[model samples]
Target: MKSRSVIHVTGAMNMGGTERMLMTLLRMKPPWKSIFLTYGTGTGTFDQEIKDLDGEIRTIPNPGSLSDHFQLFRTVKPAAVHAHTLFQSGIPLAAARAAGVPIRIAHAHTTADPSDKKGRFIYEKLMRASIALSATDYRACSSAAGNYLFAGKSFEVMPNLFDPKQFKRPPEAEVLRLKLKYGWTDKLVLGSVGRLTKVKNHAFMLDMLSELHKQGIKAVLLVVGDGDQLKTLRRKAEELSVAELVTFTGAVEDPSIYYHLMDVFLMPSLFEGLGIAALEAQASLTPVLGSEALQPEADLGGGLLYKLPLEAGSAIWAEKAISVATDSHKGTSDPVAVPPEEVLKHYYQLYRWKGGGHEQKTADYII
Candidate 1:
C-alpha cells in the first residue's frame, strides 16, 4: 500500500505565524505523508524537521510561472494541493485545477492587503475569484481572514494548533538569568512575538514605549522575531529614543518560553486574522493587550485579553499596559489549547472521506 501524499503550498516555513501553524500541522504526525512546496529552497527552519519526518520539500522556481507549477504537479501527482498564501494562492490552486487534483484547499491567514493600488486591487480581486472557482474547499485561521478572502464561500475555521505541553514547562533558568542581567527585574517586561514587518506595526510599539518613558513608567520591550523591517524598525526606535529599552532577539526557535518573562503580551498589529502568539500567551496564563483590529476570537473567555482602538493614542495603551502588567491577579486559568492530534484527526478524516474511504489515496487523483 502506497502512502498518500499532500502537497502543502506555502510561502516559506519561516518564523511567521502562518508558517508556524503549517509546521504544527506537519508535526502532528499525520498518517499520510506530506510534500512541502515553497517558492524557493532552504527557506525555513523546519526544513530539516520535514526531512526527518520522511517528508519531501520542493521549491517551485518562478512561482508566477504556471509551467513551473504544472511540472511539479505532474511530478508529485498530489491528491490535494492546499495553498496557504494570500492572493498569490490562486496561482498554485489554478495549477492544481489544471492538473486535475481532486481536493484543493485555499487557507487564508491574514486580513490586511499589502497594497491598495488600483491595478493591484483589480489583480487581487481576480485572484480571489480564481480561488473561489478552483478550490474545492476553503479554510482560514480566523473569521476575519475567511471574510476577507473567502467571503460568500463556505469555509471552515481551522483553529491555530499548538502543543499545550510545550508551554506547560517552567521557564528555563538561562532565560531568567538573561532577564536579570538586562536589569528587567524591576521594570515591566512587555513582549511580543512576530516578524518585525510593517503590517505588525512594530513602529507603534516603539512609540508606545517612548510614551511610557515620557510618562516616567519604567518598562522594557522584548521583540522575538526578525524580518525585512528589522533594520527600519531599529532606526525608528532610535528616532523615538527608545532603542535602549527595546530588545530584539531576532528569531527564536521556541517563543513559548519567552512568554514566561513577560508581564504583559502586546500585539498592536494594524490588522490580524487571528494571532496565534496571543493565543500562546494566554495559554501561558499571561495577560494580552491587542489593537482593536485584532480578532476577538483570540480571547478564549478570560479577563486575560483586552483590546483598544489604534486611534486611542499611546497614552491610553500605555495606561492599560501598566494596569494589566501591575495586576497581581489578571488572567484566568490557562486557555485550553487546540491539540495537534485533534487537528490531525480532522484533517485525516477529510482526506479519507475525499479520497473515497481508502487507506491511502492513489496519486492518480490528479486524474
Candidate 2:
C-alpha cells in the first residue's frame, strides 16, 4: 500500500520563524509523509535535514502560475496541501482545490508585510478572495496573524511551539568558555536572533548599545542569523562607534546554546506574527525585552517578557534591558512549554478533517 503524504507549500526551508515551526512539526513525526514545495530554486539550510528524515523537497517557479501548481498537485496527489506563503497562499490552494485535494489549509505567519509596494493592496485583496473561495481551512500562528489574513472569517490559532528538551541550559563550564571566547566576560550581554533585516530592526539594537555606553554600562550585543542586511548593519555599528562591542555570529544550525550566554534577549521588531525567539529565550531562562508590536501570545507565562515601544527610543529601552537582566529572580523559572504530543495532535486533527461548513467551531478541530 502507498503511504499517505501531505504537501507543504512555502517560500523556502530557510532559518526563519515559519520555517522553524514547520521543522518542529516535521520532527514530531506526523502520521503522513511530508513533502515540501518551495518557491526558491536552490538548496536551503533545512534541505539536507528533510532528506535525512525521508522527506522530499521540490521547487516551484517564483510567482508560480496556477497551472504549474495544479499540475504539481495532480502529479503528487497529496492528501492535503498546506500553504504557508501568507496572502499568496491562495495561488497554490486554488490549484489544490482544482486538483481535487480534500484538505487545503492557508496558514498566516506574519501580522503585516513591511515591504509592500505600489498596487500590493489590490493584489492582496484578490488573493484573499481566492483563499476564501478555495481553502478548506485557515490557520495562523497568532490571533494577530489570523485577524490580518482571515478577517471576517473564523480561523484556528496554532501557537508556535518548540521542544524544550532541545534548549536545556548549558553546563557552567561551557557557558564560561563561550563567554571567554566571545569576550563577553564581566559585560552585560544583550542578544537577538533573527535574520538581519530592516523589519527586525537590528539597527535599533545598535542604538540601544550606544545608549548603554553613554550610561556607563559595559554592554555587548550578540547578533545571530545571516541575511542581506549584514554589511549594512556592520557599517551602522561602526558609524555608531560601537563596532567593537557587537558580535555578529551569522547563521547557526542550533541557537539553543547561545541562549545560555545571554544576560537578556532583545526583540525590537517593527512587527511580528509571533516571536519564536522570545519563546526560546524564556524556555532557556533568559529575560526578553521585546517590541510592543509583537503578539502578546508570544509570552510563555514565564514572567520574563518585557514589552517596550519603538517610540520610547533607545534610552528607555536600554534602562529596561538593564533592569530586567540584573533582576536576580527574573527568568529563574521555567517557561510553560506545551508537550510535543499536544502540538502534534492539532496538526493530525487538521489533516484528518473532511471539510463541511464554516459554521463549525474551530475548537471542534483544534486544541
Candidate 3:
C-alpha cells in the first residue's frame, strides 16, 4: 500500500523538545511519509538531526497570514498535520481544516509562554481555537502544558521521550576532562543547558553560584546554548567573581557528551513547559538541581530539588546549594553507557499510529 504523508508544521527548526520529537518520529519507517514546515528560511541543529534521521524538510516561511495557509495547503498534500510551534498553530490548523485532513494534532510542550503575559494569553486562546477547529486530539508532555493549551478541552499526556542509547558514555570521555582546559578541574561543576534568557533565570543561577563561592564550596558553572542574554549572563558571572568558573559553550549539537562532565545539573528557571535539557541529562544519569517554580521532581525521578528562599539572600541560597550538591549524582565522570533501543521503538509506534489514522484505533473503547 502507498504510504500516507504525515506533514509536521512548526516555526523554527531549532534544537528543542518539540522538534526533537518530530525528528524521532521521522527516524523510523512507518506507514506514513513525513515532511516539515519552517517559517524561517535557514536551518540549524535540527535540520542536521532530521537529515541524520533520514527525514525531509520543506519550507513555509510565510505562515503568519491565512493566505499563507492557502498557499501551503496547495503546495503539500498531507494526510494529517501536527503543529509543534505555538505561533504557527492557528495557520497550519486552519490550512488542515481547509485541506480536510482527518487527523490534526496540536503538540503543546510548555505550561505557559514565559515570553510575555499578554503573548501567553493570546497564544492560549489561539491554541484552543486551533484544536476546536482542526485537531483530532491535543498532546502535551505535562499537565501544566495541557491545562494551558486546552482550557476547557480534554488533552492527552505523552512524557518527554529521550533515546537513552544515543548518549552512551564514552570510554575516554573528554566532556569532563576538557573542562580542565578552562580551569574547572579542582572546582565542582554545576551545569545547566538552555538559551540564556530571563525565563531561564541565568541571573539567579549566577546569584546562587556567587553564594556557593562565598561559602568556599569551590564550584563552577558550565552553561550550553547561546542567545541575547549571553553577554549579560557572562557579565553577571564576572561581577559575581565567578566568571573564571563559568563557561558558556554557545549551543552545541549533542549536549549528552557535555552532560557527562557535570557534578550536578542545575535548572533554576522562572518557568518551564518542558525541560528537555534536564530530561537528556537525567537519561544520561546526571543528578539534577532545579528551581521550585518548575517541577523538576515530577519530571526527573531522582534529583535534588531546591526552591529559591523567600528571603532571597546569599546565605540561604548557598546553604541550599551545599545541601543539594553534596547529595547530587553527576553520571560518574563519563562511565560507559549504551542507549536503550526502545527510543526508536517508541517513535515507531507514534509514526505507525499517525500513518494508519483512525482505522487502527479501536472504536469500542470510545475513550
Where model 3 places Cα greater than 4 Å from the true spot, the runs are 1-3, 27-31, 117-127, 172-176, 296-300, 303-315, 328-367
**How do the candidates rank by TM-score, highest first?**
2, 1, 3
State the lDDT of candidate 1 residue by residue for 1-367, as single tens digits. 3327888888676788777776777777665678888876556767888898788788977778777897888777777788988888899999989987778899988897877677997888889988988998888888889989986788898867777677664846866787788888788898899787888888888888998999888898999998889999889888888899999998776788788888889998888889888878887778899998778678866578888888998888989999898777676555766667666655765564343233245433322
Better of 1 and 2 by lDDT: 2
Better of 2 and 3 by lDDT: 2
Question: TM-score per candidate, in order?
Answer: 0.91, 0.93, 0.82
- Across 1-367, the per-residue lDDT of candidate 3 in tens digits comes to 2236677886766655566655555654554667777776776567877666666787765767766766666566565677876545867787778776656778777765665555776766775676677777677766777776777678776656556666556655475567666776677777887666787777877887887887788888888877779889888888888888788888666677777787677777677676766667766666666665565423544333345633465467556666666763533444321233444443333434522232335422110
How far in Å is the alpha carbon of 106 misplaced in model 3?
0.6
Q: After superposition, how far is residue 319 of candidate 3 from its true place, in Å?
A: 2.9
Best by lDDT: 2
- C-alpha local distance difference test of each model: 0.81, 0.85, 0.66
Clashing pairs in 1: none
Candidate 2 wrong stretches, greater than 4 Å:
1-3, 353-367
Candidate 2 yields a Cα-based lDDT of: 0.85
The whole-model C-alpha lDDT of candidate 3 against the native structure comes to 0.66
